[model samples]
Target: MESFASLFAGLGLFFIGIRYIGSHLKRMTGRRFRRAVAAATRRSGTSAIVGVVAGALTQSSNAVTFIAVGLVTAGLTEVRRAAPLVAWSNVGTAGLVLLAAMDIRLLVLFLLGLVGFAYYFDVERSARWRHVVGALLGIGLLFLGLQYIKAAAGPLRELEWMSAFLTFAGTADWLGLVIGLLGALILQSSATLTIMAVTLTGLGLLSLEQTLVLVLGSGVGSGLSVAVMAGGLSGSARQLAYFQVAVKLLGSLGVLLLFWLERDGGVPLLLAAVQALAEGTALQMALLFLVIQLAGALLSHPLQRPLLRLCASLAPPAPAEALARPRFLYDQALEDSAIALELVEREQQALLTRLPALIPADGQVAPPPAERQAVLEASQEVVAEVERFLSEVVQRSEGDEALERAMNFKSRNALLQALCETLDELMTALDTSNGSAGPPPLSVNLTEAAHALLDSLMEAGGEGEAVDPQLLRALTADRSALMERLRRDLLRNGADLDADQRNGLLAATALFERLVWLIHRYAVLLPDSLAEGISQKAPERAST
Candidate 1:
């Protein structure tokens, strides 16, 4: 129980350290990672090499493979590109295993020292250092665990049951292979199993040929882990896992045939290759066996596209998001003055539709993930369609009043355009969120500041302002002001912000205010001779 508790504690610390490493890595390498992932999944060969490097660095192919699977399921990566990486990952593990087997007891000592350093380090002063130190400590514990494993296995070698098992495996290669494969599958640790194979062989209880069969089986059995993990994954993801199984199984079959050649009178050369590493230390022999495994990495390139096709066949049909409600003011049959003014008014209303929900609906305490994504995408399309439609209206503006109102709508809605974009970002974060992210307090204050300005302006009702360039200047200034405030707030508070997020909140206060101000300009444009009492009314506006 003590040993198990210690192991679990080590694991707990290791995962926490990995989380820190991944977080820092994201900030430092997000742009580079995007390009790298794109390049990887585009071609099977490159993907394979990348996978090997990634597994080697992280020392966990499961994590790398799962990432590849998720990307494939999301349709960002093709299965073909993913297969090569999966193949290369097995080869990568061999290198890591060899390193672990070597006497680098320094790993454990360093970790013990780092725990002391990290425990005393100041967080703000040593944020990045803390993560690095923590990660190093975790790696050290893992190596130390291997040392303990080596110690534990030492006694098992002397047991009568163990001696009998070794005798049975040495003489019966097929049974030996089956036993090796089953042990790895059951233990779920190829490294641990490899260590066992090496330790037993070193103890003189198992011959090189017996250990070699087991080594080969370990590679083949490792495929089962991914298959089980992929069960809940989508079709594209499952195909990625299945592809790994197929590649490993096929490789295993080739090894089986090589065994046949050696057993019969077929290939002396193949038999010689199999015997080369059989006489060495189990750890060294494990390294040599890995060379055979490394060939799979190269093989993965050729098999990439086949995997992609399989994933495509298995993937669920892609979801489409094209149906959106359009927002237009009353029809154009009204007078030229009324029509242009109404169009601007109608577009303004359309843009303001999501304000009540979006203004308070966002922050750290977000709305439902799916609903947020839908609203965001929906808002973007609305803004874009409005912009395109109004660009034409801007071209059709006739007199000073009509032309002015149209231009005013163009600018105000431009602010809405920003809102639409920001809302989309908030939605994406909310959709993927765990809901403990709390609130974006700074952004909330910025939004409230904006609403206050809008209310102030509306309550002031464009008093004493005329249709001169000053009116245009005021509208544009408000737009710029609100956007700047939102931008500043977001810069300070936006840890994981997406695009549409800041824009959505900014739109409510800045863009909506500008729209109302512009309409007030339009109302002013009507000739005193032709218009009556319109210029005297107060403005009451709502921003979508």
Candidate 2:
């Protein structure tokens, strides 16, 4: 009973320590990590190195996979470049597994002592160093827990139940693989399971062959775990997750076949190679775990194209993901300030065109709430990309004309972002107002008016269309007085409206007014000669 208690406690501590280390390491290096990933160009080697670093820092392949997904989704890098990063990250996770195989008792003591003094000094309270301190503390707890598990293992081998279980697990190589798979599925950490297997083998509770099969099974199980967790994801993001799954499964099963051939056919293979490198059973298992990861990377790299095609067929890109990617603005355009600014304008116009969709069409049934939210979020993402692109243009702009155009686009981008936000608020207000009695009559009218204003702005601001500034100014004219009067009338005459309905109506009206103002501001920033042939008829007016 004492041995069981110690083992469980150690496992608990190990799990907690891994969680802290992964999470804090992410928080500590997140921005720099993102920048590193974004900086990955067409060079496959650069991306692979980034992936290795990401895996090492996070100590989890799953983390690296998702970070790559996020970067791809954000248009920071392409799926092809991100693919290598995801593949090599698995290799990086082997660092911890190798570290765990060696003697770290003294290192554990040093870490705990340093952490103790740091905590006493309240280093955790400092924003800059908190993550560092927390990560170190997790390292201390991780090895300390390993020490406890090792201490418990010797006594545990003497137990009748434990002996029976070990005997059963070793009866067949396939059964050992199953045991490993199940353990990884439950724990969601193949490294953790592999480390435990190393511990058991070192204590003579399990033989090297049994431990190898277990490690192989854990590899496949880790992939399955990622697949299960990322089930909700779709499009390129889902494809990346599937890529991880492919590498893990292919690598682990391939190594398992090699192991069988060496053992049965007397062929020298991975087992013999590891034996030559290390003598101890624990060290050999660690080396094997690493070999399995490398095997996955090596096997999957050349097959990435076919595997990606398979993934795409299984999980096609979602509409929202397609919508989120910027239609224009490539890196090469940045070399020429003129071309880059033009691309920024085109992208901003594309974003503007999406505004009207936020409001449901009248007389037609409203779009699904999930569909609408996806569109809104996609627009926000594009808006962010536009802002980033414009910043690059600002840095490259040389003269007054180029600088002026860049600043103009920047101003318009700001207004466009404001319009998206205000429209979102307006939609939320309208949804809230639709109670048991349905939306108030005033809310319905306000939505229709806002929709009409959006249509006009879309036309006037659209590509190759000359904007009549005076006409646009009239179209988006301030309606504060009209809205205020309507609000007063609603309070005086809207007796049937519940409190929620009345508040919703007021909020909707306020947002609509702001929406109109934003549109007007956007129009005022439009260039005089929007298209080649068309000329500005209205007098030039100062930008408000």
lDDT of 2 by residue, 103-152 (tens): 88898898899999999999899999999999998888988888889888
Distance from true position, residue 29, model 1, in Å? 8.1
RMSD (CA, Å), each prediction: 16.0, 4.5
Error of 1 at 38 (Å): 2.4
* Backbone Cα, N, C clashes tallied per candidate: 16, 1
Give each model's whole-structure lDDT. 0.56, 0.84
TM of each candidate vs. truth? 0.52, 0.85
Residue 468 lDDT in model 1? Answer: 37
lDDT of 1 by residue, 1-544 (tens): 5545654564454344444433443343343454476467677567767877766554455656776765554334556666777777667666655765466777567766766666676542475565555555555655655455455556667789988877776678778777767876775545446755665566566776677678667667766766776777655567777777666665555665665676675666444664564444656556545654665555545655775566557655333122133445322422365475576555555445444354342233445556655666656665665565566566666678777766766666666666455445533433332224533554455444434333333223232232333343344353556556756765687667555554454444444444445434533433343212324332422221
What shift in Å separates residue 170 of candidate 1 from its native position after superposition?
A: 2.7
**Candidate 1, superposed: residue stretches over 4 Å from native:** 1-35, 43-45, 106-125, 173-189, 263-279, 303-544
What C-alpha lDDT does candidate 2 achieve relative to the native structure?
Answer: 0.84
Report clash pairs, candidate 2.
Answer: 235-317
